[model samples]
Target chain A: MVEIEIDEDACVGCGSCVDDCPNDVYQMNEEKWKTEVVKVEDCMACLSCHEICPAQAMEHRDIHVAKRLYIDRKVNDVLDKII
Target chain B: MDMEIEEIRGTFRPELIPKETGGDIEDYEEALHVLMKFVGSMSSALEQVSGRGANAIVYQAGKRMGHDAAKMMEKTDNLEQAMKEMGEVLGVEFYFEMWKPSDQEGYTIEKGNETVVKLLFMDCVVRQTLRRTGLPQKGPLCYLLYGYMVGAVEEVMSIKGKLDIDHVGPNACLKTLTIKWGGK
Candidate 1:
């Protein structure tokens, strides 16, 4: 099962996730203007919402996390020291 | 910043088979990254030069690879069994599973003369390479996997097949594979 958490404080109510999700997993709470997980059953954990969210308000748990081989660890180490 | 390069020196004999693969983990990692960059650049360039034709070319190449890889395997018309065998051949790198909506009872669907199934690809090397290059989904590179699956299924079942991209997500991709009866 996929568990999704929406940070209400961080949510900007932009509705990008509501538009971007293919499975209609999210819906806008019109009254509050924040995003809510309406249909959690259909959420495939695609994480497109996470990528599009400017505020990084969403998190997905217990899902098949794809391998991210693109990140160069050595470069990251250097950045870690500088940042 | 200045980068340091370390060179390795070795003695080679023409007649003898090399026993060990020389290189540390860092070397392998560096080589893998370099290869990924090379492939990413090649795919992007091919797409730019050949446009949509690039997909056909890449698909054909992937199909050829699939056929060659599955040639030695036992042939069967059982789709489920063939998929299981193919999973072993593809290994963990291309991990995938049959998927259906929660409301649906079974994975396979039959309509008319076609048998359809949805495959959810969780970890695909092509997807990784695309992400490495910062390319969007549903590009020509995606066709490679589509053709590869079709080719493998065709080889195993001795039937014609097609794969359609349903949805592409960062964590997973859903593809519809339809096998047609009778010819090809």
Candidate 2:
């Protein structure tokens, strides 16, 4: 089963993930305005919500990490040194 | 900057068998990456040159490839069977599976003469190449898979089908495939 974690401190309460998720995996907590995962099983690990969330507060565990061959290794090496 | 190119010299003859391929796995990997960049550049240039029509051009090409690839598969009216067989034709690079929302009872929905199913593409080389080239989603290259699916489905089921992009994410993309069970 996919596990989802939301950082309330990092969450800006923008509701973008709530609106963008096709599976309704998230819902806004009316009390705190922070996002909460309502249906974890329904989450397909598409990661669209992560892109839409401005605060980058969501994390998914035990999900299939798709291949990202786009990242250039040399560029990453340069970035690693700078960061 | 300086570069070096190593040349391999080997005697070749038209024969029943060859001794070796004369290259290692790293050679293949380097070649593959170069090809990826070449293809990505062409896709972007095609889009810039033809505007929206580029999608149709690439789609037709993919549809033709799909038809050719699925030619050896057994034909069937069963949507699931056709999908299963077509999955092999798409292979692991374009990995995908049928998907549905939690509230949905079944993967396929039947209404009158049409059948609808959602497919979640998990590992798509086209998506990776697009991202590598810094192109946006749902561009002309995306239609390649759209036409490929419809072509395979049409060939297998002998029915008219259409695929519509529902959403695109970095990890996966959702598409709705609809098949009309009547004449071609």
Using DockQ as the measure, the top candidate is 1
What digit string (tens of lDDT, one per residue) describes model 2 on residues B75-155? 999887887888887877788888888789988999899999998899998899888877888998899998888788878
B1-184 in candidate 1: lDDT tens per residue?
8977877788777555555567788888888888878888888899999998999999998898778777777899877788788888876777888888777888888889888888888888888888877888899889889878978887888898999998888888988989887757
Instruction: Give the poorly placed runs of model 2, Cα more than 4 Å off.
Output: A78-83, B13-19
CAPRI-wise, candidate 1 is: medium
lDDT of 1: 0.86
Query: Per-residue alpha-carbon lDDT of model 2 for A1-83, expressed as tens digits?
Result: 89999999999999999999988899999999999999998898889999889999989999888898766776787799999
User: Model 1 Cα displacement at A5 (Å)?
Assistant: 0.8
lDDT of 1 by residue, A1-83 (tens): 88999999999999999999878899999999999998888887778899899999998988989888777999899899999
Query: Backbone clash tally for model 2?
Result: 0
Question: Which residue pairs collide in model 2, if any?
Answer: none
Consecutive 10-residue window with the lowest summed lDDT within model 1 chain A: A39-48
